[model samples]
Each structure stands twice: as C-alpha cells, then as structure tokens.
Target: MIETIFRTVDVPAEHRFEAMRENMTNVHAPAHLSSAHAIDFSAEMRLVRLGRLCVWPATVQPARMWRTPRLIRQSDPEQYHLTLMLRGTKRCMLTGRQFGPHEMHMTDTSQPYEVEVVDDHGEIKMIGVEFPKALLPLPADQVNRVVNRRLPGQQGIGVLLTSFLTGLTRHTGCYRPSDGPRLETVLTDLFSAVLAHHLDAETALSPETPQRTLMLRIRSHIRQRLHDQELTPATVAAAHHISTSYLHRLFRNHAHDSDHEGTTVAAWIRHQRLEAARRDLADPAQHAIPVHHIGLRWGFSHHAAFTRAFRSVYGMPPRDYRHATCRPAGPAH
Candidate 1:
C-alpha cells in the first residue's frame, strides 16, 4: 500500500518545518532544510513505493535545502533524485539552473548541491522519485552526463514518465502492495528511456525495454486522443506505425499483469471513454452540460448507447449517477 509519509497539519504549527526536514532526510538523503517563514510552514506529502523505487508527491512551503560534501561523506544513500516541479519555481546555484513549472531536475546524492524552491503567493507543488543508482540499467558515466540537467516534462518519454508518476500519486487507492513489482518494472523502464533519450544512448537499455516503452507510449497516445470520435484500434495503431494485430498482441502480452478487465485495444478504448464520461457526469462544474452532450464529448455517439454502457459499468444510468452525486444548486444565497 502507498503511504502518507507526512502532513504538516498533523504536527504542531511551530514544529512542522522541523518535522518536514526530518522526513525529507529519511525519505531521500541527508540535507539541511531552512525556511524564512518557518512558523507558517505547511505541506502534505504521499510516498508511493514501487518496489525499490519510491515517489514523493508534495506541496511544500518556500524553503532552502542543501547537502554539503561533509554530509555526503557522513551518509550517502547513493541514490538519484529526480524532481518534477508541478506548480512552482526553484533555483539552484550549484547547477546554475532555474526550473519553472512542468520542468524537472536530477541530483546525485554523492555530490554537494543546494536548491531554493518558492512560490510567493502560495505553496510549491512538486513530485520527486528516488531510486538506487545501481538500479538504472545504464553505465554510471552515461548517467552522470544528465545529472543536474533540466529535463522537460511536457514532451516525448518525459511525458510518459510524468503521467505515470502523477497518475500513481493521484490514484494510490487503485493499487495494492502486490502490484509493486509490475509498477516498478514500468517505472524503471520509463526512467531509463527518459535518461537514454537525453544522452543519445538508447542502445544501452535492456532488450525488453523497447517493447515495454512502446506499450506505454501507445497507452499514452490512446489517452490523449480519447475525446476524438475517430479513436479506434486502427487509428491508434496507425498513429504508432504498428499493425492492428500487433497492437492486440501487445495488450495480450501483459494481460496477466494488470487487474483491468479488458486487454484488447477496442475494450481498452471503450473502458477509457466510459471512465472519462463518468468523471464528467459526476463533476459539479459540468452539471450544466447535458448528459448526452457529455457522452458525445467522450465518443459515445448515441444517447441510448451511452446510457446502456454507463449503466453497465457504474450500476446506474448517467442521469441517475449525476443526480445522486451532484446536489442541485440551492437558490443562490
């Protein structure tokens, strides 16, 4: 199961910053943490354990954290820390870099570094993943080339990695402890792919990596185009330059690893479309949108078909589902 490693709200206000520092040290590596506004510090962090790799999703107050050469010698986890900035900016003097929203930075625990993250108006939101340096399939020299470098999270393999990280963080309840090994394999492959792509060292990845990475890319592609009415197995396969039969086999290859009911391409698309329409139906802000219109937006062309499909999965028609979850606006106060 995933863990909520820390929440400032659980600690006394005066001690929250101190608690955060201690938790960070334990979770990642030893470092000194200080904040100009420590009295009002607040944050909530969740730790998702994927086998030997761990991801930390947090929204924290402005603070400065640094590791010295002395601290590195004292206790080095010998881990690589990859951090994605979701909603703030951070400046690092050692790397001579500034990362804005949607950018990522990598750090080595064996080296000294310093970072100051801030958002003057609110808290800083970030997700960080740490794994043993030895777990990466590439050589240490190749890995060293990319450390302290800024990686963009908005494109290519980076998109796949960021999506997987954020999805895991947001839906921890959907996974079980037993799912750790499978999730870890996917996480490691994607991380390796991202690093390899940056270093022009794709050939260094293991033989199984390309197939797994391709599957992840296919899934990501399918998700982004779920709203299109033409989304189907053929269209999806064409986009990826693969045959439809090959796509089916790809899904078949991993059927046992997933708890999802469907493994075929058509089934996967239908499931995604239904889940998306279901969220829109339950959303209060979308209540003003008609049920059939919401269905159409997610590729369900017919009202009766949409109702039948939605009811089959959700145990109720879209209208009833909406009514049960969304209270009608009481007369505007």
Candidate 2:
C-alpha cells in the first residue's frame, strides 16, 4: 500500500517559534526565518508517497516569510523536485536561478538550494511533485539547463502542463495499481511536453525517443501478457518481431542502468502479475476462486514460486495478503 504523511502547523503568538521549528525539522528544512505576528500564523503540508514518486501540498497563512539560509541542506531518495504554486507567492533560488508564482521549476537535492516563502498578509499554497530523474527522457545537459530556472507558464505547452497537473492532483486516489501503467504513460507525455516547450525544440525531438515510444509499447505489451505463464524475452521479442538483443536494449535504455536493469522485463511482468493477483484476492467477486487458481490465472505456474513472489512484493504470502485486505474494520461491540 502507498504511504501518506500529513502535517499541520498552527502557531499562536507565544509558541510560533516552536511550531516553525518543528515544521522545519519535518520537511528537513535547511534554515528558516519568520517575522513576529500579532495574530496567529499557521501552515499545512501534505505528502504522498507513490512508489518512486512523492507529491506534497503546502499552505501557509498570516504573511510570515520563510527562507532557507545558504548553509542549510536537504536530501532525498528522489532524483528531482518539481514545484508549482497553487496560490500566493514563493521564490526559490539555486545555482543562481530563481522561480516563482505560476512558473514551475525543478531542484536537484544533491546541490544546495534555498526557497523563500512570502505570505505578505495573504495565503500561500503550492504543490510539489518529486520523481526519479531516470523517469524523464531528456538528456542530462538539456535537463540541467531547465533545472532551477523558471519556465514560462503563459501559453501553449505551459497551459497544457498546468491543466494536466491540476487534474492529476485532484484525481490521483481514483487510480489503482492496475492503473499504474497508464499513469506512468501520462506522466511521460506531460514531462515530454513540458520539456519540449521549454527547450523550444519540440520539432527537434525524434519520432521515437526510446524512453517515450519504445518503452511505452513494451510496457503495454507486458500488461497484456501478464496472464501468460510462458511470457519471456524470447516470446515477447517474437511477438513484436524484434530480436531478443533489441528487446534487451530497449529495456536497458528506458529503465535504470543498474545490475537489476537486466531483469527489468521479467520484474515488470512479475509486478503486473502480482498486482492482478492482489486484486483478485481482495475482490469479493472472486472469493469463490481458490488463491492458487487466482495465481495460476495471473500466469504463475508454480504455487510455491507465486507464494514467495507475492510475499516479497506485498510483504505477505497470498493467503495472508487476502485475509488482511478482506478483513473487517472492527467488531461492532
């Protein structure tokens, strides 16, 4: 299951310092400054973790200003941070670049950066989406040029980017693991569109960037064959009329370049199968089907292998995952 972290900060006149300090610690804020307010001040931040990505929404009130000092630092497992302002104003500076308001910017946590939040008696609201750098298809040099720099959000691709983000934030919960593949596609397109717009090089992009078209096709094919126990690189390559070497190249180019990258195709197939099995296990409509049958239906030939894979992926064996998901909230008393 996905994990979500929600935090709220309300600082009365007397305890404002304490509240601010606590919030800073929570966000791993490098440094902060606040002005004395006659009235109370408050802020709210919500963080949602989806596999390798994280989304955060922040709101602040009573016109207090917060800044990260030069010496402050922060780190994360994520590769990039995208910040979009929903309401009010915020300015972030990194590598001598600045971004604010309707504009969007990306930050590399490995480097030192500062964000200035200015309320000025008004409210401030912002949303931040963080994901792995590998998820983006752009070259490192091109990506570097855009990072920490404010991109225009006034017309054309900017409008599309804004609309997509708004919709994504509002409707994320409606998506299920079965929908993960689709969501990943949408994210790829949105990121591509945004980058192409900023670089003024949309026309320069190839008809099939490996990360965009090729990987997408491979993932779609994998999802369709999740129920086929014989699915393998050889079979998949044959289906696509491509050589196994070509298939391996595609996976290596799109996924990370780690030792695990060699097994990505198989890993992807297993992930989809596990997701399908989990759904079937929790679904009352399928309660009549034996767990072993459900595993078989999702392409697991060996019950033992399925049990081990299910446990490794979901932190429990099939029966245990089903029982927990199917359990009642509590006794009525």
Candidate 3:
C-alpha cells in the first residue's frame, strides 16, 4: 500500500517564511529558499512500500530557495535513498558531488549533504527509492564514490535504471509475495549493471552468498529452454558458464532430503511440461493440436513415459487429467 503526505504553502507575506520552513523541515526538502514576497505553493508525496524497498513520488511547485539538513532521518528501516528527477531541475550536492535534472542521486542518512534548487518555477517531480545498505550488492566504498554524483539519465545504464524504476512503480500493486525474491534479484541486477557502467568495483557483491540468486537464474533458463530437446543439465550449465557438476550441486543444495536431487529436477521439469500440456489440451483456442504432440512440445520425448509421469503427478493419466480439468462437471459427487 502507498501512504501520502501532502501540504501546500499558500501563506501571504506575513506567514510565508514560517510555512516554508515548516514544509522544508517536515518533507526534508533538499534546497534552501529565501523570499520576500508572499508565495503560493503545493506539494504531494506518496511512499509505497515493497518488502524492504520503498518507492516514492513527489511533486511540488512555487519555487523557493531551500536547504535540507545533512542528517535527515528516515522512517524506513532502510538507510540508502536513490532519487530520480522526473521533471523540472534540481541542484543536489552530497559527498562533494552535484546533480541536476534527470540525474540519479544516492544519499546515506548516516551522512550529511546539501542540495539547491535551480529552476523551481516549473513542476518538480521525482521518484525516490529507499533500500538498506546491506541489501545493496556493491561495496560500500565503491558505492560511496558515486553518491551525490550526477549520472547521465539520457543514455546507457541510466536509461535502463530509470525504466526499471518507472515500471516497478507503475506495476507494484500487481506483484505478489511469490514474486518478491525474483523482484529483489531484478533490482540487484539493475544495480550491478549501473555500478558496472560507472567502473566501480563490486567486490562487496561476491557471488558466494545465498543460493536464491543462482536458483532463480537456473529456473529462468530452464523455463526458456523447456521446449528444446538438448536442454539438459550439461547444456544449461555450459550456457551459464558453470560446470555440470556445480549445476547438479546447486539443484542438490535446494532439494528435500527424501528426494534424489536429479529426480527432483526431473520431476519439476515434468510437472511444468504436464501443466503446459494440460493447458493446451483444454484450450478451445488450441483444439487443433494433438494431446501427444502437446506433451512432446513441452520436452516429453516418449508418450508412455509422459503419460505415466503425468498420472503420477496429477493423480490421473494425461488424457483423463485433461478431460477432468477441461470439461465441465455435470454435478459435484
């Protein structure tokens, strides 16, 4: 869910300074503004929580020179902030680096920094993502060098980074709990790609940590190659530049104690194939495809073996399972 904190500054000459100061302190506005005349301004901010990550969109108008304190506190459990300016211009300085419009900035609440607004007349829109320092895969020192530095948003890694943030914000509601780990992986990749473009050392993200990432990659690869007859463990491992034995080790590492690791992998593959075959069998739109062919299309080389495996997994043979699932029941038993 998303929570919003919105306030508008429309005080006349008498209260402009007080109103501006209150807003600056409350929202932690990154600029210092001094004005003599009365001002009318409004700003809307929304922060959406996604697991350990937070996405926020902010829009403000009625430009004023404002300075944000270096030791800004965060309500989030995360400590790092990444901001992308969507519209208007902003001059941000942190760790002795300056950033402008369409640029990305990283700020650590543990440190202090200053930002100045250059063109506040126009609508200023920004998207900020907050994450924990531990969640970041890059080394702290390497990541620190880029903090407050202006990264070009027009090309290369910046474009990809922006696109991912925009897409995530737009579709955050549709994401499910099952997708959390995968989403984290995607975010990690995007961050890595960004750091790589900047030529920063990523020793902090050493690949020896959790098995979740390798498993996710392996699953994605397997799904994509499910239809190919040559998509064995050796082929899959070679494609990923890992040895077949290591790939087996990864699968074994994740399997339950009672199941043979190879059998577990094979069972998962068979189950997916069976599910795809069942969908094809039941789809009136795909009525022309033969049931056996549908099974073959999903990596089942032998019809008898496919049928037996399907029955074992689904409690019925392939044809019977298809009939029971696809056809409407006359009445409940």
Candidate 4:
C-alpha cells in the first residue's frame, strides 16, 4: 500500500488545510498555499519514494498554490513536478493552460508558477511526481518547453507514464526498498520519452534511454495483446515494425535472470499469459467462470495445455487453485 504520510482527516477540520500546506512545502518545494474552504477542508496524500524520485497521490480541497520569486529565493529544490489530474480542473498561469481529468501538466520548481483548482467547490484529485532536474537526461532549456503545458495522458508515451504512476499508487507495498533504483530508472525513461516526444527531440536522449524506452514499449505491447493466441515473437515484432531477431536480442539483453528463466520472447509471453490466468483464477468474482474458459481467454488454446503451464508455475491446476483461494458466491458479512 502507498504510505499515507500526510492526511488531514485526523486533524481538526479548521487546521487541516494548514497541516496539508505545511507538509507540502516541507516535503516538496517551498510554496504558498490557500483554500477557500479551510474551515472544513479534507485531504489525503499517499507517497512513495524511489531513489531520486518521489510520487504523491493527493485528494485535496479546491485551493490556490503558487511559488513566487521570493519563495524561490528562499528555497529551490530544482525539481520538476509532473501532475496527472485524476479528477477536477486546474489552471496554470505558467503555461496559460487549463486541464482536467486524465490530462497532465508539468512545472519546474526553479521557476515561479501558479497552479490552482478552477472548480468553485470540490476536491481536486491528482497524482504527482517530483524528481531532480538532472534525472531528465535533457538540457534544462529544452525541458522548459513543456513546463505547465497540457500533456495528453490518454495516448502515446504519456499513457504509459500515467498508467505506471497509477499502478505504483495502488501497489506500493508490493515493492521492496531494493526496487527503488530500478523503479527510478523506469520512471525516468518513461518521463524522458514523453518529454522528448513533445519536443521532437527523441535523438537528444542518452544512449541507454532509447533502448530502455523501447523495452518498456515492447512489454506494454505484449501485455495488451496477450489474449491473441497468435501473439508470437514474430507477430509482436511485426506489430512494432522491427525484425524478429532484433526483438529476441532485446529480450535476451534485458531479461530478469535473477528471478525466473524468462530469457526468451516465447517464454516471456507464456509467463505473462499464465500470470493473467492465475489472477483470474484467484478473483472471487471470476470463480464462476469455467477453468477452461479462463485459460482460453488468456490465449491458452487447450485445457490440458493451460493446466500444464499453470501447474508448472503455480504448482496447482487452475480449478484447484481457484477452489483454494475463492469462497463460494454468497452475501458479504
């Protein structure tokens, strides 16, 4: 679970806004914050810290937050704040843009900017990440091109980054402290790809950035099409317009040998398919679905084949696994 480092629910309603404001400036960059509903404000912040990057998912009352020249002089983290709005609307004076749910906007903490909820009343829900400017792998001036600009999170690399942040918020406890460095790398690459795409500067990225970015794109493609029985390495390569050999090479270079032997493209595909089926088997809501149908849904052509694969990984047949984990369909207590 993501850690609730700061939450206003426990504080007196009259003091909740001030508590939130204090935590924000202390944990993030220095900024001035105010809310029209301070007397009855309610908010929550869930945070996860990766190496040099930190993500915070917040549910906050309508408020105005800004950094002025004076605030900048007082303190500057020299970080970039990328906010993915999950609900409500916001207006940013830095880019002269207004955005709402499923859209993203970025700001450089080194510069003065204003970000305020434009809604007359309601909570503004957003997930944000702050990372040092040096982690971007691009020149500061080039990165400024997107500062506070409305970015499309519904399509392209923006979708991947947004999905990643959303997943992290939901499953933060699934990770260990040792995972920080790798998670940091993945976030940096995805963030870099989004910024580079907007600037038309893909070639400006560091040598390792493109390879890591391509691997992520490939993994995403594979996951999306796992239901297709024809989703072989060759077909996957064709979809991405790369040769099958090159795809195999990419997998070999990036395979997680420390865990399982998913060193080949075919093995990776099978593993993902089995994992999907496993999740369905464990879901109580899906317990009524036939074991064979669950297998077929995830690209296993025959019941026996699915059983063998599932047992090989999970040490039990799908039906038995489901029986052990899922209770009979009935009313909740």
For each candidate, what is the lDDT? Answer: 0.88, 0.64, 0.62, 0.85
Candidate No. with top TM-score:
4
Candidate 2 residue lDDT tens string, 1-333: 143544344335567555655654444333445544424556666655545556667676633333343433443443666778766665654344544567777766545556665555567787777667777666767876777777666565565556556655665675665444545555556666677767876664555543454455566577778888889988988887888898887776656322121346777677778887998899866766789999999999999999999998788899988887765335458
Best-matching candidate per lDDT: 1
Tens digits of lDDT, candidate 3, 1-333:
444454444455456555656655444434345532335445556655555666677776534442334333432233667778777666653334545667887666555655544444656778877667787777677777776767777676577677667766765665655555556555566665566568545344556433534555576677777888777777888887888888778777655321111334666565557667877777766665677887889898888988887787668887776666575434558
Q: All predictions: root-mean-square deviation over Cα?
A: 2.5, 9.8, 9.4, 2.2
Off by over 4 Å in 4: 256-261
Off by over 4 Å in 3: 1-38, 62-78, 93-101, 118-121, 177-185, 208-333
Candidates 1 and 4, the one with greater TM-score: 4
lDDT tens digits by residue: candidate 1, 28-95 = 99899988878868888888888888899998888999999999999999999999999989888786
Clashes of each: 0, 0, 7, 2
lDDT (tens digit, per residue) of candidate 4 on 141-170: 999988878899999888888888897788
Candidate order (TM-score): 4, 1, 3, 2
Candidate 3: pairs in clash: 31-66, 31-67, 32-65, 32-66, 32-67, 33-65, 33-66
Error of 3 at 212 (Å): 10
- At residue 285, candidate 4 shows an lDDT of 91
- Work out the TM-score per prediction: 0.89, 0.50, 0.51, 0.92
Model 3: how large is the Cα RMSD against the reference?
9.4
